[model samples]
Target: MADKAPSGRILVVDDEASLREVLTIMLQREGYDVETAADGATAQALLRESDFDLIISDIKMPKITGLELLRFVREHAPETMMIMITAFSTSEDAVEAMKLGAFDYITKPFRNDEIRLIVRNALERRALRQENQTLRQELSQRYSFANMVGKSEPMQQVYELISKVAPSKANVLVTGESGTGKELVAKAIHFNSPRRDHPFVPVNCGAIPETLLESELFGHEKGAFTGASGQKAGLFEVANSGTIFLDEIGELPASMQVKLLRVLQEREFRRVGGTKDLPVDVRLIAATNKDLATETKEGRFREDLYYRLNVIHIPLPPLRERSEDIPLLINHFYQSHAGHDVKISDAALRLLLDYPWPGNIRELHNVLERCLVLGSAESIGVDCLPPQVRDAAAGTLLHDLPEDGLDLDAYLAAIERELLLKALERSNNVRTRAAELLKMSFRSIRYRLAKFGLDVDE
Candidate 1:
């Protein structure tokens, strides 16, 4: 078999020409690209010219010492790994070099095996660090505001609110209907905040049984309860210095609400069966599809706790209200799931836009994925959609009217504007052709366009 290509680049720095040559030859034999530097200054020059995965240097050298070179590497290329070599009599210098960011150290009378093992371990650590850094960057980009997929005014407002609130320590309460992406908003805030490096713990208040709620939030000591098994940390303790997202906060029982409020006010809590209070510093982000304010009035939720969690409020608009964003969201999900090769027919796109998405973005994504997977490989047509989506009628819109009621005039106007826009899109923006598509006379279409502030000569 052919020899494997060099896996890592190594720079060997020593004042002794013989030692440098020996170390270089040994590393090169192990399938590493190796370079020799006669002194610390020469090593610095080589580092500027080329990148090295690992650096091995002699602690005792003239002009610039190994410790000095280590410091320089730390400030200039902190990601690069370094190892130091020192005489047994001057081992303390090796210890100092370690403090100065050297990866590891070896004594002068060391075996080649010892050098090889330490060098391999240091290179492995460097590779792991690089991998972790890359993953963090990808996650940051994935949750960024630019990736949220909306250009409507309502979504723009949401993006602005999240940006302003992410840097603060204030608690946030996100209100929206089911499938409106409340958890997504929570993640965007946490990832953009200073606590991005720490854990992002999510707890579903509705999912966990009431009996285990307290212990889950405040952990339990051994024998605290039947299934205690051993001592364990709670979600709050686990989320220290980061973020804890509480979904369906409205579902939290009355008893747990009091304890949660205390934690919010005191910043400390004792374990289920322990005495000492454990201090926790975490940002709280709560989400609920229910009207918490109304729940408080109806005596179902505590008003004080509601105020505490509502320090900052973010209300997400339902998909029907932001219908203009549907096409953008569809394109985003399509590109993400099916790539550019699969296409969605214009007729299918129109039905998707007309359908009242009561399940919101989540439902849209699932439908698109299903179509791409089960439908034709080349295109997603009307037949690819579920019956509910394909047969969606104008009456379905009335079924989702808010409990508080809506302005009939404003609601009808929105529908009319949307239909007009769709017609214009289908007709390639020609007003006369758009009127024909909508089955309206040119005069009527022109008057309606002027009324909606969308008047144009063409």
Candidate 2:
């Protein structure tokens, strides 16, 4: 027999003392920790005191019946599994117990092996359920809004829009430059919404061949196409009761756009070459770097479809526009990369900030990851930065010195102070925003301000 410590605990409830003793002894011998209760009332009290993995109760009991106990367990201990004990005369009641969510039932005078096997199956089922629940929680955390790192006003507004629209059944359009974390925002909305327990399906409309795109979205019956061998469920049907994120929606063919519009209008779609209209309940989220309104006006996209998808619009700011958020994002990526002992010099960080990130947050993340893997020094200096960053940093500060020479430290400090003051003025003395504007972390900017005795509130 396997170890009882790993199998989990069980509760046996019956009015008959001998039957309770027999079941407890049998379960314990089968490598399960066992407890006994004389009646449903005792079982309920025990349940309130301590948790059990499985509950075995008699259908007819004094004070509280087994059906009532099932209700209590369902309401209070939903994670626990329940089984019923009944006689041949009350076998019909056991079927009713099954409808009430009983895991299984064992008749009186049943063989010892039969009862033991039933109990084992119920425990196994409970363990599987608990495992799945834990995985779902981990996935939810991975895609939560906390993973989208930024505190800029632009990001704050984005957060507010997401929170407000996530709970609604409206379609959303996310517009931004490529690599602006549009997919991340889509995942955050899906995981935070009511449909989180269901699937969150994503498909890049541009990646799939135009010939196969229709079948991919709506699926097809066997023999529907040249290579079709089996009936298949489409992304929309797979995402029923959840979310479907269509990336690069602007790249969709005009015919597919019309089909998508029909689905949005009627909440139903016919598969490629299939006659039956299949209904779907899905929260649609579309993303594209293209100016969709312009696309609609130019006849490249359907105007009605564009309006249907643009019901809730979220535009992500380019990284250069949110430069103040760079340092925070760097630190976030550093911690994520497990670079506990690594640090980047302020000079090096400034170089990163000065460069216009055409690729946005995604590019920054990739660069940081590269540094963590390739850079050897504990303190990452300007020399350790990528060639483009280093060259840009050096070229920006190149200048001739006067014959008398210059106070380099004081000269740089004065430039720093002026820039800080301007950033502060622009951000209305919000230190966090000022830090973002200067491409420094909140803590780093605060330290510099305090050193200069310029940490004044407006």
Candidate 3:
């Protein structure tokens, strides 16, 4: 679901300058920001001056061998990635390098694509470890909370409640914004509690209609409904010894809400149009974005049902509240967007930090995907952005631009041409919104797009 790849620096060392240059070029072609050294000694000196995400060195270097460098990396730069390179092509060297903490190994005359893939894979592993650390940190932040990503004060309260009731069979109600990742918290509780290995089945209460929601939650005998040609086990039956996540619980219709409340009170329910009362042994974890309490007060949602599902509550904050992590999220996306060491400009970083992000984490990711695809160049700039992003960036980082009195006509014209053609390409000669972003909406933009005769869209 996430496309983050490791994108830190890598130290490439070889006794031969030509080989070093070739390797650097190959990696740079893949969007990696690379630096090089001619020998292990030089590589070590660079390590002293800077930190690297990973290292690639020749096994037989001038003074210090790759193995020695690996030893130094293991002790001094424990997190650094060390890849041993050699002409020897012996498994012994590969085994030795790995034992000494080398992330991977490659021999001389390596294909360009192979080198890129290996570095990408190694860096991805490193990124995962770093992200896991972030999750653990969140645990402490959301301390006593069930599994989730944020550790804000609100999350801490949720954590406290989860810890108190996870071991018991009490029902829970988790509330938050739509993208708040509540299901993650539900699984965390089920897995952490006594039913760690038991099944954790989830059902969206809002997705099925009122007439079918009951059957969906409590199974149905054959021909119970128009489409019920065969008997089907309901969610509760499937999750008998485990947990059931009732997502969007507020959307449950009033008729079904009454039936659901009965089950919570008696721990039993009969299938639709069936005479058998089936007892269920399942833990309930329900979540919704609505304030069921307010709905109850307004006589919209049921009060008894609200009380039944509200025994333990957890709420997650929207991503903007955790805006401090925007940079980390940007880096996280950059690493996973399927490229080598794609770097973001400081201006872009500043831009991402200030966006209102109405869609929260989901919007941030969408913006990042657009940027990655369109701005694969070494550096991303304000002009590279979609207009809204550029506008957002300008809003947050506005300053008095000293009148330099320069005509941006040539630059603007070239960009307009590109956008027009891009639009034409997408519509197969039609100019539309997709093309508009590529070209722009100004009269001058349309004029230039015409100048190129790119009127692809009829």
Give the winner by TM-score.
1
lDDT of 3 by residue, 365-424 (tens): 787777777766344544455666545533423345437532234334444445555566
lDDT of 3 at 336: 60
After superposing candidate 2 on the true structure, give the runs of residues whose Cα lies further than 4 Å from its correct spot: 1-6, 339-342, 376-384, 398-458
lDDT of each: 0.87, 0.85, 0.74
User: Evaluated with lDDT, which candidate comes out highest?
Assistant: 1
Q: Which portions of model 3 miss their true places by more than 4 Å?
A: 1-148, 155-165, 334-343, 377-385, 393-458
Instruction: Name the lDDT of candidate 3.
Output: 0.74
Model 3 lDDT-worst window of ten: 405-414
Better candidate number, 1 or 3, judged by TM-score: 1
- TM per model? 0.84, 0.81, 0.53
* TM-score result, candidate 2: 0.81
> For candidate 2, lDDT tens digit of each residue in 115-201?
877887888899999999999898888878766788989999998998899889999999999999999999999988999999999
Q: At residue 256, what lDDT does model 2 achieve?
A: 96
Residue 82 in model 2: lDDT: 95
Q: Write the per-residue lDDT of candidate 1 for residues 1-458, one digit (tens) a residue.
A: 95343279999999999998889888888889899998999999998998999999998899999999999999998999999989874678888888888888888877898988888888889989999999888887888776898999999999999999999999999999999999999999998999999999999999999999999999999999888899999999999999999999999999999999999999999899998998999999999999999999999999999999999999999998898898788778777765754566655666776678999988988898888787765677665677677556334465877686655654465457668867887887899999999888999999988765566656
The alpha-carbon deviation from the true structure for residue 365 of candidate 2, after best TM-score superposition, in angstroms, is 1.9
